[model samples]
Structure formats: C-alpha cells, structure tokens
Target: MVVLRTGPVAVGGVTLGNHLILAAGVLGTTGASLSRMLARGAGGVVTKSIGPEPKNGHAGPCVAVLDNGILNAMGLPNPSQDFTGELGSLGQKPVIVSIFGGTPEEFAEVAGWFKGTAAGFELNLSCPHAEGYGAAIGVDPVLVEACTRAVSTLGMPTWVKLTPNVTDITAIGKAAERGGATAIVAINTVKAMRISTALRRPVLGNRYGGLSGDAIFPVAVRCVYELFESCKIPIIGCGGVSTADKVVEMMMAGAQAVEIGSAVQRDIGIFETITNELYAKKGIEPGEIVGCAHE
Candidate 1:
C-alpha cells in the first residue's frame, strides 16, 4: 500500500491519506505496529509518546475495562533514545511522533530527535496519568504555550494534544495557537478511576487513570466544539470516535481529523470499515463538514 495516499486532508500543514489517524499509545510501540495500522487503512499514525529518557511507567493493573469505556494509566512508557531506530522502517509515511517532557526545554530536546524525519509532532501535553509531564504541565496556559513554542521553532507541524481535565480547554487551545502551533488535538482521555468492589481498592495500580471509549465521545465533541470557537488552528478530535457516524459528528463539531484508539483495540480493521462506511454515506470530505455545527 502507498505510504501517503492523496486526500483532502491538510491539517496543521500535514497531508494525510484520510482523516482517520491512529491515536498515540495504541499499536504504536514499534515501526511494524505503526505500519500495520497504515496497511489496515489508517490515514496515518502517531507513535506512542516518548520522552527525554526511558520510562518503565507505573505498576501492574494499568488498565481496567468498564461497561462504557477503558480506564488506563500507562504512565507514557517508552524506550526514549531507542525510539529513533523504529522510524527507519516508516520512511515517507505520514507518521507524527508523539512526545512529552517535564519542561519546555525537555520537550524541545525530545522533539529534536526526530527533526526532518517525522511528518509532524504531537506534543503530549494532555496525558492525564503522567505526573511530571502530560497534564501536569498542560493545565497551565503559560506552560502549554512555552512547550509548543519550543517545538514550533524546529520548523515542523506541531499539534498540541490538550487535556480535558481542566475547566476550560479552549484556554489551553488558544495558548497553543499563540505559541504558533499548526493544529490543536482536543480532549485527551478524561481523568477518571474505577473502584474495584470485590478487591475493595482502586482498579488501576496507579490508583487513577484516564477514561476513554464510547462514554467520552460526547465530552470530546464538546471540547472540539469549544476549541473550534476559540482557536484558529486546525483541530484534531480525539477520544471515543469509533464509527463513521462518530467521525462525521466530530467533524461537525469542528475537527479536521479524528483519532481512533479504544476502538482499534476491539478491531484492528476498524479504519477500513469506517472508510467504506464514510464513503458510502454521501462521500463527504473532511473539509466540507468541519465546524458545520457553528453554522
């Protein structure tokens, strides 16, 4: 299959085969996994979030399955320096490297590893489970802007992933815009946890985790709608988007693209399914419906 299939998508100065991108942290741990998703019909893929150093992440029981969604606290584990080798197999593919750091300098340092190699960068400013990085630095507008600006200066299409744990997501979205971000990825998993009744303790080993799946779809839509109203940059809607209908709904809410994570866990061929379903249901392009709800 072609690595970069021509399409109508041009979000954040990046061209993709389609609007359905594989979200970070799912089947993105290696070059093979990333390429598998692309072969399965995903427009592109975001690698699992990497950092300045290798991280083993938290203890066991990192994931808890709920009726409505999945709660996970993966802690953003990655090989860090070793991640560069994984990219050799993905040459010319629209692969955006997801990165995180505790500070602006660290963020810049991590992103610099992929300079001229990655199609773009998705700053992990929104991961709720990661303490020093992720939401810890993302909740504040100042840090978001600083981290974004640091990476933006490297001359790559930078997309800041925002956390929904905050009261106002648009504030952070605007901050990314002010920092010269090419696009804003709205609503990472919602901060949440589940208590085990039989064990009488938290289900996750981390005690807290971010919730994602069908349940958070509405929350994601709301965040995208809000961010659309405030930020001029392209918006990538992420969170429980699983179906063709959800993709359209996300676009209507102002998302130029959508990321599928939990659904991919259920079915690796989901991208192909949604692509056929989307084309069948009127063959609408991504640009035509983005922010349609505003009208």
Candidate 2:
C-alpha cells in the first residue's frame, strides 16, 4: 500500500486523509471503481448522483470533447438501488454519496436510504442538464434551503453543491448554510452547448449540457472565494481542477478541499501526481494553504 503522506483536510466535519476528492459523477459508481480510485491515491470518493429511482440519463452522444474542455449532459444516470451495500464494502475511506430529487421530501427519502452507509451526502443540486432536478432546484434559494434542511436530518454531514448559473452563487451558498448544510461545494458545471457543424445540430443528446474542465476553473475559484466570504461553512471547490498548481490555487481561493472530475478522464493517475507535486515543489500541504490568498 502506497500511503500518501499528503496530510489531512476536513469538509463538513468529515476528516479526509487528504484534500483530493474524486468529484461526483466521475469514476465512482460501483465499489470496485471506488476502490480503484482510492488505490490510485484519491483521498475520498463522491458517488454519481443517484435519485429515488433509476435514471437512464440522456440518449446517445452525451459527451463531447472541446478544445478547452468537455461538454456533458449525462442526465444524472444511476442504478436505482439502495447503494448502502456497496458503500459499506468500501471500508474506512470516506464515501460521500451525491443525490438528487424533485423536492425536499424526495431528497430526504433518498438520503434516508443511505443513512448509515456514507460519511456524508453531497446534494447534487446543480447539474445543469437534468430536468426537474439539479439546476432547476438549485437555482432557487428557497428550494435549495428546503432540500438542505431535509437532507441534513439524515444524521450525516451534508454538503450542497451549488450551480454557477445563478446571478449570485453566494446567495445559494448562504441559503444552504442557513438550512443546515455542513459545507458547500461551490460551482457545478456551467450551462453550455455545442453545435455540430457537419450535422448542423446540437452535439449533445440533451441539446444543452454542462461545460467542465480548464474552461471553468476561474469561475469556480471566484465562486469559492465569494462563498467563503459570505458563508461560514467550509467550501469544496469543483470545476476544472487538473494539476497540483490548480489545487493550490483553489485552496488559496478559500477551498478547503478540491474535486477533479473531467480531468480524471484525461489522467486516472492525477491524484497521486498532484499530491506528489504539491509536496515536492512547494513543501506545502493543502491544509496549510486553505484561504492563503485572502491573507
């Protein structure tokens, strides 16, 4: 076992072995996949957003690789089974289950199903392309607060993932905090689309998709900084994080921990690589750099 000495960072009171979290909706579906990421040095894993029932997601051609980033409209697909069994098998690694629903009650019900199985819950309130869920619920502060309050009752730490599509993300972040969220994951993918020049139609099956990767890193950093200023809760930055320098940048931008999703597709070994680079180049731990930019 190549134990990474990257030090510890906490989010929503769950103490992670390190600050590198496998972003939700990435390579974290089955227990085997989760274990694989852990073995590769991910400090924790966030499962794909699972709803009350199984979701087939969008149709064909759901993902597109762009010059600057990746566009995806997966529609939050997942097996509609109780994932507690799979979560329980992951041993001591912190597993943060990401969930979504159309209403606060529904969100609570889905969270209840995973009650003793996960270290925390990340409310997938900001998936831009999912209808009747995700950004639709996340864009409204009232709904955001209601969902946060409902899920917080599950007796596990709850982190609300907010959307950058709103005029002021901090408003949503504040609402999440007000509703008892333990932490806030700032900035989900941005709403975007790509038109196929050859086909003369939208490339994504959903017609619209969320843009991720290096294209949104600056936006994510800004959201984290603003949310940290307005809310007292810890912030988990998620956007276009791909390198150790970007990780440090996010920490300086007030993110206690950072999530890398699309970047993992480009390099599965990114976790170990970033941690090693952080330690070797700066002699600084992620925990040591949290909010350093504000000082």
Candidate 3:
C-alpha cells in the first residue's frame, strides 16, 4: 500500500489534500477518469471545459506535435452530459467543473446547471482557439468581470481561468477579483499554430490552436507572479509541469496550487511520482513550499 503523505492546502476556501491538481482539458472528462486520478494520488481534478450546449469541436488533424510541446485546436469538444451527475460520481474527492460560454448569461446558465454538486467552478474565459468562446471573452476585462459576476452569485467558489494571449494579464486578474472570483487560474494555453511541411498547409483544421507543454512553463510562472502581485485571491498555476521541481517552482512563484495536464498524458502516474519525490527528496510538505521563493 502507498503511504501517501498528507499536506492540507486551501484554495478558494476549499481544502485539498495537497497542492497538486489535474488541469482542465486533460484526463478528467468523466467521473471514472477522475476516480482513476484520485487513486493515483491527485489532490483534486478539474473537468474539461464544458459549454452551455454540446460542441462537436473541430475536424481531424487537430493536434500537432512540436519539438518542445503540442498544439491542439480541439475547439472545446464535449458531449451534452450532466456535469453535476458526473461530479457526484467522484465520491468524496474534490472536483472543480470547468465551464465555458460565449456570453455572460450563457456562462451563468451553464454554471447554474452544476451548482450544488461541484466543489467549485472554473470559468474558462481564456481558451485561445475556440470561436465565440475562450480568449474572445477573456481578453476583455469587462467581459471577464461580467462572466465572473454572473457565476459568482451561484454560491460556489468560482475561479476565472485567464489567457496569456493578452498584453496585460494582471489587468484581467484584477478584473476577475473585482467580480467576486475566489481565485484566478493564471495562464491558459498560449495561442500558436504550425504548418505541415509535406502538405504546405496549416496543421490544425482550425488553422490555429493553443500551445501547451514544457515550453509554456516560464510564461505560466510569469503570469502567476504577476497575478499574485496584483490580485488578492489565490492563483492556480498551470502550463508544462511534469516534475516535482516544477511544482515547487510554481508555488515559489506564488501559486497556491499547481495543475498538471500535458505531463499526465506522457505518464499517468506522474502525480504519485511528484508527491513521493517532494516527500523523499525535498523533505518538505507541499503546503510548506507555497510561495517560498518570494520570501
């Protein structure tokens, strides 16, 4: 049996077993998958961003593997499923449902559907490639605040996921805080694209996609740092975190919790590896290192 070390870390008033969380859009579409992650030692899970209505996403050739990372124009594909029902299936594990929409009313409507079941809601105002969704709403502080306000009234902790594609991320973070968000998830995937050499055409069917993986680690840290400086709420750092060292680095950069996404795709057991490493090698609890670097 694995003797997991326990370190309590609180985000948005909800306490988690540790600081390591599963990022949105990776390995958390269903309750079963989330259960698997919980068994693997993940502190919590954030489901893939679901819209008000079902989205078919984009066509084939949506993902392109780059030298340093991966680009995907998934277009936020998701089936019309009951999000609250899925959250209930995760048992006692904390689950934050990621929701998206084109308008503030749409965002509120979707969030209302899952109000009581979720531990919290992540307002995905910052996906770069999705049309009428994601970054389109995220870049404008007015829209970000409006969307956040619409969901904040649901009586659940709300986190606004911000996009790095903007010129000033702190402005967006402040806007989210002003709208009553409990926390801000700094730095979603960066906007980028690639072309297929053989076909001499855009790689993704959508012509562009969000870049994720190791390449975005620094950018993520920067955003987290800036948000921490500007906003009073907690910050959840996510980008290309695959190792315990990266987790620590993110916390030092001022993230109360770090979300793992692309790294899990390479190895499902990464959560265990990171937690074990933090205990054995560093001899420091995960919560102990939150914002250590700033001091």
List lDDT for all candidates, in order: 0.90, 0.87, 0.86
Lowest lDDT sum, 10 consecutive residues, model 1, at 1-10
Segments in model 3 whose C-alpha atoms lie over 4 Å from true places: 1-5, 280-282, 285-288
lDDT of 1 at 90: 88
**Candidate 2 lDDT tens digits, 204-277:** 98999999999999999999999878999899999999988888788888998888898898898998888777
TM-score versus the correct structure, for each prediction: 0.96, 0.95, 0.94
lDDT of 3 by residue, 60-152 (tens): 688887778889999999864555567776665688889999999999898888877788899998899888999999999999999999999
Quote the RMSD, in angstroms, for model 3: 2.8
Ranking by TM-score: 1, 2, 3
Model 1: per-residue lDDT, tens digit, 1-295?
A: 1122236577897888889999999999999999999999998899999999999999979998888889999999899979999999888899999999999999999999999889999999989988888999999999999999999999999999999999888899999999999999977899998888999999999999999999999999999999999988899999999998898899889998899999987888999988877764345444667798999
* Candidate 1 to truth, TM: 0.96
Better of 1 and 2 by lDDT: 1
lDDT for position 75 in model 2: 91
Highest TM-score scorer: 1
Q: Deviation in angstroms for 247 in model 3?
A: 0.7
